[model samples]
Target: MALSSLDEVRERIGKAARLAGRRPDAVTLIAVSKTQPAPRILGLVSAGQRVFGENRVQEAEEKWPAIRERHPDIGLHLVGRLQSNKAEEAVRLFDAIHSVDRESLVTALARAMAKSGRRPDCFLQVNVGDEPQKGGCAVPDLPRLLEQARAADLPVAGLMCLPPADTEPAPFFALLAKLARRHDVAGLSMGMSADYESAVMIGATHVRVGTALFGQRGTEDG
Candidate 1:
């Protein structure tokens, strides 16, 4: 079931990429495995799924070590809000940090990277929708945050965003792409299970999909 789902999602990504005159390989699909068990992740690994996203640092720390030991080639992304205190652990575990949205986090991550001598690609998440409860930095504050990240010598890969739910996502995706271009960044981490195709059409380099690939959450442990 997972294999077929993976194949279908890949095919959809390819089609979306082609429609946008972009290569399918240009868009990476991150299988979000927040509540997923290690065995199910291994199943996807066996099926050639290499990139995975986890929402929490502690959950990832608990689940990924052994899986990574067996498959060192797999890339892990931290796709949730990262606390300043967890900076060192997040740096040690994730290959990419997609929620670098604050100045303090930038400072902590920079220090952690310096101490660990391992710098993961970082994305500055923007609250494109201006929501009061989201994890991204506000749009007006992005420039300052970007500067801070650069000054700290952090590898700011690109921009990430989650549009307001139930509304059209294209406008938000376009905004993020524009922000990336304005900031001279390269990667755009937008889109998820329901609207990844729209995201790819607009200019998303990375799409995080879980339910589509692994089934609905809580139904399967993996």
Candidate 2:
């Protein structure tokens, strides 16, 4: 069942990419594995899924080290809020971070990278929806944050966003893409199971998908 679901999601990604006149390889599918067990993730790995996203550093630390030992080529992305104190652990565990939204986190990540000699690609999360509760740099503050990230010498790969729920997401996705263009950043990590196709049409380079590939949380064991 997991293999078939993965295959179906890959097919959807390919179709979405083609519709955008882009190569399927241009958009990476990051299978989010937060709250999932190692065996479940390995099941996806067995089915040829190479990239995964996790929400929490502690959960990833508990599961990924063993998984990486067996499949060293897999890419792990941190797709959730990151605390300054965990910057070092996050840098050590993730190949890319998709929720970098503030100057302090950037500074911490920079110091961690310097000490650990490991630099992970980073995306500035923008609160395109203007929600007070979301974990992203306010849209108005994006430019300043970007400048701070560059000054810290972090590898700023792109911008990421989570559009407001129960509303149209295209505008938000377009906004993020526009910001990335203005900043000359190439990657746009937007989209998920519900609206990835729309995101791809608007030029998303990386899509964080979980339920579409892994089923609802706690519903299946893989």
Candidate 3:
């Protein structure tokens, strides 16, 4: 079931990318593995899924170190609200971070990177829908945030966004793509289980998916 699900998702991504005139390889599917057990994660690993995303640094620490020791090719990503204090641990654990939204985190990550010499790929999360409760940089503050991140010598790989729930997501995905191009950033990490196909049509470089790959939460726990 896991292998078939992965294939289906990959095929959908390929079709979407081709429809947009982009190569299928251009879009990376990041399995959202937070709350999933090691056996389930290993199941995907056995099926050739190498990249995974976690919502918290500590959760990732508890599981990934052991998993990675066995499958060293696996890439872990932090796709959650990152606290400033966890910067050092995040830097050491994640290969990529998708929720860099503030100046303080930028500063902390900068210091941690310099101290550890591990430069993880970073995506500046933008609140494309302007949701007050979301965790992303405001559209208006993006330029300044990008400046600060660049000045800090952070990798600054791209932009990420979680559009308002239950609304059309294409517009938000397009907006993020425009912002990335305007900022001269190449990667766009926008998309999830539901709207990833739409996001691919708008040029998303990374799509984070959970439910489509794994079964519903708590349904198949180890």
Error of 2 at 157 (Å): 0.3
Quality of model 3 by C-alpha lDDT: 0.93
Error of 2 at 171 (Å): 0.9
Q: Which pairs, if any, clash in model 3?
A: none
Off-target runs (Cα >4 Å) in candidate 3 are 1-3, 218-222
The sequence of per-residue lDDT tens digits that candidate 3 reaches over residues 1-222 is 444989999999999999999999999999999999999999999999999999999999999999999999999999999999999999999999999999999999999999999999999999999999989999999999999999999999999999998799999999999999999999999898889999999999999998889877742110
Clashing pairs in 2: none
Clashes of 2: 0
**Per-residue lDDT for 1-222 in model 1, tens only?**
443999999999999999999999999999999898888989899999999999999999999999999999999999889999999999999999999999999999999999999999999999999999888999999999999999999999999999998899899999999989988999999999989999999999999999998888742111
Residue 113 local lDDT, model 1: 99
Q: Backbone clashes per model, in order?
A: 1, 0, 0
TM-score between candidate 2 and the true structure: 0.96
Per-residue C-alpha lDDT of model 2 across residues 1-222, encoded as one tens digit per residue = 444988887888889889889999999999999888888888899989999998989999999999999899999999999999999999999999999999999999999999999999999999999999889999899999999999999999999999998799999999999988888999999999889889988999999999988788752111
